[model samples]
Target: MTRTGSGHPRHSRPGDGQDSRRRRPPPKGRSPRRRRRPPVARTATANGLPSGPRGHWFLVAAGLLVVAAALTLDGYATGVVGETRPGPPAGFASAESAEVRRGGPVVNVTGDRPTSVRLPGRTVALTFNDGPDPEWTPQVLDVLARHGAKATFFVVGSKVARHPDLARRIVAEGHELGNHTYSHADLTAVPGWRLRLESSLTQRALAGATGLHTTLARPPHSPAPPAVTDLQWAAMKELAAEGHLVVLTDLDAEDWSRPGTAEIVASSLPAGGEGAVVTMRDSGGDRRQTVEALDLVLERLKGEDYRAVTVTEAIGMPSAHRRAGAVDRFFGAALNLAQRASETFTGVLRWALFIAGALTLGRFGFFIVLAGVHAHRTRGGTRRRNAVGGWPSPPPVTVIVPAYNEAAGIQATLRSLVATSYRGELEILVVDDGSTDGTANLAAAPGFPGVRVIRRPNGGKPAALNTGIAQASHELLIMVDGDTVFERATIGRLVRRFADPAIGAVSGNTKVGNRRGAIGRWQHIEYVIGFNLDRRAFELLDCMATVPGAVGAFRRSALVALGGVSGDTLAEDTDLTMALCRAGWRVVYEENAVAWTEAPASLGELWRQRYRWCYGTLQAMWKHRRAVVERNPFGRRCLGYLTLFHVLLPLLAPVVDLMAIYAIAVDDPLPVVAAWAGFVLVQGLIGWYALLLDGERASALWILPLQQFVYRQLMYLVVIQSLATALLGVRLRWHGIRREGTFNEFTQAAGRSLPAGGPRRP
Candidate 1:
C-alpha cells in the first residue's frame, strides 16, 4: 500500500509482492482459461456579448472525454494530457516579480461609515425583492402596512410590466422603489450593451409602474460583470446630479431557495437583532419562516434597544478585517496558480486535461443524440424489426479472434462469431499465440467449420492481430478478443458506419461480460460511463483516440497503412487509432454495437491492466508530440485537445487532491469544512451526470462520497506509480495481459507478466 519508492510498474510476478497465480479465471459458463492483455503505459464561458450560448451538455461531455483520454496518457506524454507545468514557482526571485501582485491592505469601505446608527427613538429598515409577484407582493405590503413600517421593494422590469398593479400597490403602501434589472438573468453574463440595457429597462418598467423620475438598481442574482459596480456607480453619479442613489446589499436571507419560515427566521435574524439589508428576494411561496425570522429579529432588536437604519444614517463603518482577509485569500490563490504554472507547466496540462476530457465527453453526447435523431429521420433503428435481414449489406467482414493459451474461450468465441447475424460471406480467424494449452487442436475439431486456425510464436498481441489481419480475405476487418462476444446485431451495425468512407474505424460498445462479483460490477460501471460514453465524445471531436481493441472494426487499408500494429507501444490499439487519425482517417463510435468483454475481475489484475494502458499512452503521446506545433488540421486538433486537457492539468490533479486533503485535515474547522463540502458538492454534481450516463442512477448519490476513499486514493496511487516510472524511463517487463482461469477456477497469481486469465489449451 505504501508507495513502492516511486518506480515504474514493478516488473515482478503477481505473487512476487506476496502468491502464485497471475490472473483470475473467466466468468461462469465459460471454460477455464488464462489470457494476457498488453501492458501500456499511459469548459465554459457563459459569455457576455456572445450572440448565442451554444454547446450545452454535449460540448461539456466532449471536454470530459478529452481529459479522460489524457488520463490514459502516461505522465511522460507532452502537450495536453501529460505533465506540462511545474508545481508553483519555488519562492519567486522576489515577491515583486509575481504576475498577479497583491495590492494594498483589503479595504473595508471606500468612506467612513458607522457600523451602527441610533436615533433617540426606535429605528428599523425593511427590505423586499423580486416583487411584482401578483400572488405574494400585495400580501407582503399589507403586512408592512399593518406593522406601520416603511420598506423597500426591489423589482425586475419584466415582472413590473406583467403586474404593474403589484408594483403600484407597493408604492401606494408607502414602500420605496429599487431597480433589479429587466430580464432577471444572472448579471455576471451581462456586460457592455446589456449592462446599459439592464438599467434602461428597469427605469422604463418603473416609469410604467409609478414614475420615470426615480433611480436605484440591484443586480440580478447578486451577480455583476467586471466593473459592473463601478459602471453602476458612475451612472449613479449622473443620476445623483439629478439627486438619486444606488443601493447594494450586505444582509441576505437566501430567500430564493424558499427556506421554510423557521429556517428563514434563524438565518436572517441577528443575535441581538433589528436587521437592515439593502436587498432580499420574494418570500411568499414559503415565507412563514421568513416572517417568523423577521419577528424574531424585531424582538431581539427591541430587547437590545439597537437601531437599524438606511445607508444614509450609518456614518462610520466597522473595522474590515473579514473583508480584507477575503482579498488576501484571493491574492494567495493568484500566487499559487502563478507558482505552479512555472515549475512543470501544470496550467497548460491541467487546462488540457479539463478541456480535452470535457470536449471528448461533450462530443460523445452530441453524436449519440445526433445519431439518434438521424436514425429517427431515416426510419432506421435497433428496434424497428430491422426491415428484414438488418440494414443493407456491408460488404464482407473478416472476424479475427486472437488467442494465446485461450482454450477455455477459443470455442466459445468461434461459436459466437459463427452465430453472428451477418450470415453472408463471413470468415472467422483465430490466431493462436503459441498456446501452451491445446487451443489449436480444439479449433481443428468438427463443431466449427468456417473457422480457421493460424498458429504462431507469441511475439505479443500486435503480432497475433497482425497475422490474422494479413490472412483475412475481406477489407472490413473486425477484431474481437477471444474472451469477448458480440450481440447478434453488433457486427452489422458496426460495419454499416463504414459506408461513409471517411470513417476508417468503428468502435463497438464493450460491456462487462462478468457481472456477478463486486469488482466486476464496479468495472461494469467504468466501461459504460467511462469508456463507451467517453468514446462518443472523442469521435465527435475527431480525436477518437483509441478504437478499443476489445471489439471494433477497421478498414483493411487503414490497418495495412499503419504497418500492422507495432510493439513500440504496449497499447497497440490506442497507438493504431492515433496513427490512423494522423493518416487522415476518421474513427466513429457506435453505441448500439455492443460487445461484452470480460473485465479483470480482481484488483491486482485491474491495476496491471491499467498500468500498461497508462504506460502505453505516455509512449503514444511522446511519439506524437510533434502534432502540437504541426499545422495539419488533424495534428492541430489532436495536439490542442491533448495539451490543454491531458498534459498540463491532470498531472496537477494530485495537487488539487493533496490540497483538498490538506484543507480538510487542518486544525481549524471553518475553511476545512467549507473546502470539503464544496469539493464534494462539485464532484457530486459531476458524478450525477457520469452515473446517469452510465445507467447507475441509483449508485450516483452514494458513489460520490465513496469515491473520495476508494476511487480517489487509489487514483493518486496509480498516478504516482505511473509517473515515477514514466519520468524515470523505467521499462515494464510484463509482456501482456494473460487471462485468469475460469471465473470459478480460482487460480492464484503466477507468471511475471502472464496472469491466470488465459484458457489452458485443452
Candidate 2:
C-alpha cells in the first residue's frame, strides 16, 4: 500500500477511507522521504500560563456565577427576605403635626410645603394593599364589580411582573392602581437607593402590564398619618420629590392576620359613619376573611348611603394613572420578559437537577451490579480455558509503539516490551511520527537490537498506527503508548485471551503510574472508578466502546478487515473498537494485563487532553450513529448508555451544583450539604471497591471528595466546551500532552531493571 502526500493512505472511496483496502500509488513527483521543519516550542508567560489559545473555563465560571447571583437576588427580592413588621422600627418618633395627623389619608408632599385633604362626607375610600394576586385579587375584584364599587390596589412589582395579566385586569376593570414597591420593600427600612429602585421597578411593571404608571404610592407596613414617624416622613419626602402622593389608611381592617370576618367588617367601618380611608389585604396570605369582610362592608355602607370609591375619587384628586411613554414601555416589556425567563430557567434547572441526580444514581447502581456479574462470571482463567478446550499454542506477536515527542519514555517502553515474559516470538516496532525530538534516533540506538524504528512524517496517531500496522511481521499485535510500561506478564496475559478465537481485541487495565501529585491522584481515581469499572460492565454487555491506546491487543486480521486505523476521529481507539464491534467482532477487558501510563501533571494539560477525548468521542458517536438503528448490540446497549451517562447526564450535572448554591442562599444548607455528603459517600464506596478489585491501596480514595470541587468541575467544563464546539461545527485537532518521563520513576520505584542505553535527556 502506498500513502498520500498528507501521510494518509489513499482509498478508493471518499467516505470509505477506513473501510477500503485498495490503496492508490503515491502522488507523482512526491518523494517517499521528505524533510520537515522542526516543531515549534511551546512558550509560556512569566506566570507560567501557556502562551497559546486562551482557555474558556474562566468565562464558564463567570457565567455560572452570574446565574447564581441572579437567582439569589431574585429569591431575596421575591419575599424570601421576609416582609418588615407592620410597625415603625424601635425608637421611632412621630414627626407629623397635629393638623396633618387629623387630616385625610391622601397627602401631597411635592408642593412648596406638605398639604393634606380629607375624603368628603359619606364617602369611603376602599384600598387594598400587597395585591394584584392571581387568586385572591380576582375574587376581591369580583366583589367590588358586583357591588358597583371601585377600589385602589397597591401592587407589588415582582408579583405584577409574574402575573401581568392580573395587573392588566386590575386596570381593565375600572380599578385604580398604586405603587407598592417592587418587592414590597418597606420604605423606612430600606436604603434610599433601594426605596427608589423598588418604586421604579413597580412603575415599570405597571407600565409593561397596563401601559400606565401610578403616582399613588403606599409604603408597605405603614400606619395611618397619625403614626408616621420621622424616618417614615423622610422617605415620604423623597417619594414626593419623585412626584408621588403618599396614601395612608385611616381605618385598619388588619385582615392580613385572617381575623374573623365579622371583626374585619367592624374595623373597616368608619368611626361615627365619617368618611375614611380603609386598608385591607388581598394578598400576602389567605385573604378569605378580607374578601368576605369587603362584601359585607360594601353592603353595609350602601345601606347607610355611604358610597365606596377609589382614593383619588374620595379625595377629589386627579386620576393617579398616567399613560407611559414609548421608552418606558419598551424597557418595561424587556424587563418583564427577562424576569419571566429567569423564572422559567430556574424551574427548568430544578427539574434538571432532579433528573441528573436520578441518572447519576442509576448509572452508579447499574455499574456496580453489572461489574459484579462480570467479575463473578470471569472470576478465574480456568473456566475460560476449559470452555475453549484448553489454551491454544502461543503465537508470534508484534508490539507497536507510536511516538510523537515521546523521547522521555520511549526507551523505557522498548525495555518493558523486551522484558515481557511471553513464551512466543515477539517483534517490536516503533513508529516515530515526525517527532522534533530525537525519538527515532533514541529508539534505533544500539542498546536494543530486536527493535525496528519506522520514521514517517507527522500525520497524527491514527496515521502512525496505520503505518506500524502495515509494517508489523506477526499476526498478533499489541499497541501501546510510548509513555506506558507494561508488567512482564502483561503481554502474555493479553495474548492468552486470543486462545478464544471469537475475541478480536482485548483492553488491558491501564493505571496511572505517576500518582504522586493531586492531579495524578485524581486521574488515578477516575481510572479505577470511572473507566475500569465501566469497562467491566461494558464487557459483559458486549458493547465495548474503547480499547484504550495506552495498551490493547488485536489480531492483525481484524485490523486488516477494518482498514487498519481511521483518522476520521481523534479517538481512533474508540472509533476502531466500535467499528470492530459493529463488524461482528468481540472486544473484552483483561484486568490481569496491567500497564502503567503517565497522566497529565497540570490542570491545563488535563483539560486539553480530556477536551479532545470528549470531542472526538462525540464525533465518533455521530459518525457511527447509523448503528443505533441497526440490528446490533453496539447500538442498543453502547450508544444508549453513552448518550445517557456520558453526554446527556454530564450536560445536566451542572444544574445540581447551581441548585446547591441557590439552596444555600435562600433555604437551609444542611439538606444540601447532607445530600452532597451522601453522594460523595456513595462514590467513595465505589472508588474503594474499584481499588480493591485493582489491587490498589484504598487510601487513595480519600481524595475522592475533594475531586468534586476541582477535578470534577474541570471535566464538566470540558464536556461543555466539547458540546459547544460540536454544536457550532468547529473543527478541532488532536492535542498532545507534553511528556514528563514520570513512568521511569514508577519503573525505578518498582525495582525493575532497564536495558543499558545512552544517557537519558533531562
Instruction: Tell me the deviation in Å of residue 142 in model 2.
Output: 1.5
- Minimum summed lDDT over a 10-residue window in model 2 is located at 1-10
Candidate 1 per-residue lDDT over residues 48-122, each given as its tens digit: 011223332344346545444333321212112111221222232332222112211111122332111221234
* lDDT of model number 1: 0.55
Residue ranges of candidate 2 with Cα displaced over 4 Å:
1-73, 80-88, 92-94, 97-103, 380-390, 444-450, 648-675, 724-730, 745-762
| Residue 40 alpha-carbon offset, candidate 1, angstroms | 19
Q: Let me know the TM-score candidate 2 reaches against the reference structure.
A: 0.85
> Considering every candidate listed, which one attains the maximal TM-score?
2
- In angstroms, the error of model 1 at 541 is 1.7
- Each candidate's lDDT (Cα)? 0.55, 0.79
Q: Residue 401 CA error for candidate 2 (Å)?
A: 2.0
